[model samples]
Target: MFTRMNGIVCLTMALLLGCVASIATADEALDKAFEALKTYKWGQDRATLGAIDAAVVASHKDDAAKKDLEAKLVAVLKSDAPQAAKDFVCRKLSLIGSAASVPALAALLPDEKLSHMGRYALERMPCDEAVAAMRDGMGKVKGLVKVGVINSLGVRRDAASTAALVGLLEDSDPQIAGAAAAALGAIGSPDAAKALGAYQAKAPKELKLAAADAYLACAERLLADGKANEAKMIYMTLAKPDQPKHVRLAATRGLLAAAGQK
Candidate 1:
């Protein structure tokens, strides 16, 4: 009995030591991977990033580990790393990021080259900070970069952005104005619908059609939210004869939907 117990003890000790060694190896791999990621570029072997990827997968069930990884990624974003490296880090953060990742991601939003990927991560983060970051970025970027931020806000359907977006409807750049209209439509709030309605009359001919479509989109959203009366009113407006044929058709369908008719 004594000999058998000794053998079991030895086996247990060996397994424990093996586990410790494995953990040490994984930690070392993670460290090396981060170091390599600092200068990582496209077309190079992806094995370095692969290490971090595996760590992310393994951390799915471990919230603490995930947060630690997120911190590391945020650091990479703040580093003087190549844009390629930051881009890779953003993709990872999109998977495991939290509010902690917001500041780093937000800092990239005004950068024309980095804004898209930055938005890519912020868009997935379900936090008020992420929305605020994009909103703040709106004031700092212009042209297509600003438009991209506006589109991200729209995708989030952030109701808080409604007022700002409504103001953007009059931007000197038609493209910016048009994107704002589309975003407000996606938001689909009563405020958004109201804003679209107000913009329609003054909208340029080229923009009239877009504004009408956006109005229709807002009405659909209202109907979905059980605001049938409000939806019917918008549908009725678009059902007018002066509206485009397609717009009138869509309005008619919306009117029927509001009435609970087939």
Candidate 2:
């Protein structure tokens, strides 16, 4: 009986060793596939990065595994990789990153070529640090770069950023002003709606359309928040004869919708 038991123990140990080797092999394969993302391009004959992407990893990995993978990607962001490669990594960060990736991502926000991609990652990172990074970028960057960061902030729906966005409304650059107005509209906070309404009355004709659209968006948001009275006021402003015909018509429809809300 002792002899048979000893043989069984040996067999079990061998099987466990084999299983360990198999798992090790799988982890190495995944690592190799991820390396392909460093310089991947669309329509390539072999796109190995797809096999180890955020969606795949998230689906397969436990919390610990996911954190380990995220740390690796964050390290790649600081590597001497080409901009395109970094951009690819940034895109992946959107689906996997957390506050830990913020510093690496923030470093790219001022890069003219990479700011948009950088913000692309930051915008989707579900952490306060991400918003703070973009908010800081607002004051540090310029022109379209600034606009991109502002847009990301709006997408975050950061009510706390209302004052900063409102300040941009007076920027000399019309594109910047328009983008700020649009960002505020996307935020759709009561403060954002009020700022747009105040600016719409005196904003140049060139910026009127943006303000109008923003007003309409804010109204829809207010209605969703169960504030039909506030939404109606925005709709009323947009429906006036002075507003653009298409915008006024849209507002007219929005007005009816807001009124119908219980």
lDDT of 2: 0.85
Q: What lDDT would each prediction earn against the true structure?
A: 0.91, 0.85
Candidate 2 per-residue C-alpha lDDT over 1-262 given as tens digits, one digit per residue, 9 for 90 to 100: 5698899999999999999998787778778866775665555435576556733455454777767777878877888776766887888788878888899999998999889889989998889999998998789999999989988887888888899989999999998899889888888888999899999987888998888888888888888999999999999989999987999899999989988998
Candidate 1 TM-score over all chains jointly = 0.96
At residue 212, give the lDDT of candidate 1: 94
lDDT of 1 at 111: 89
Tens digits of per-residue lDDT for model 1, 212-252: 98899899898999999889989998999989899999999
Best by TM-score: 1
lDDT value, residue 19 of candidate 2? 99
Off by over 4 Å in 1: none
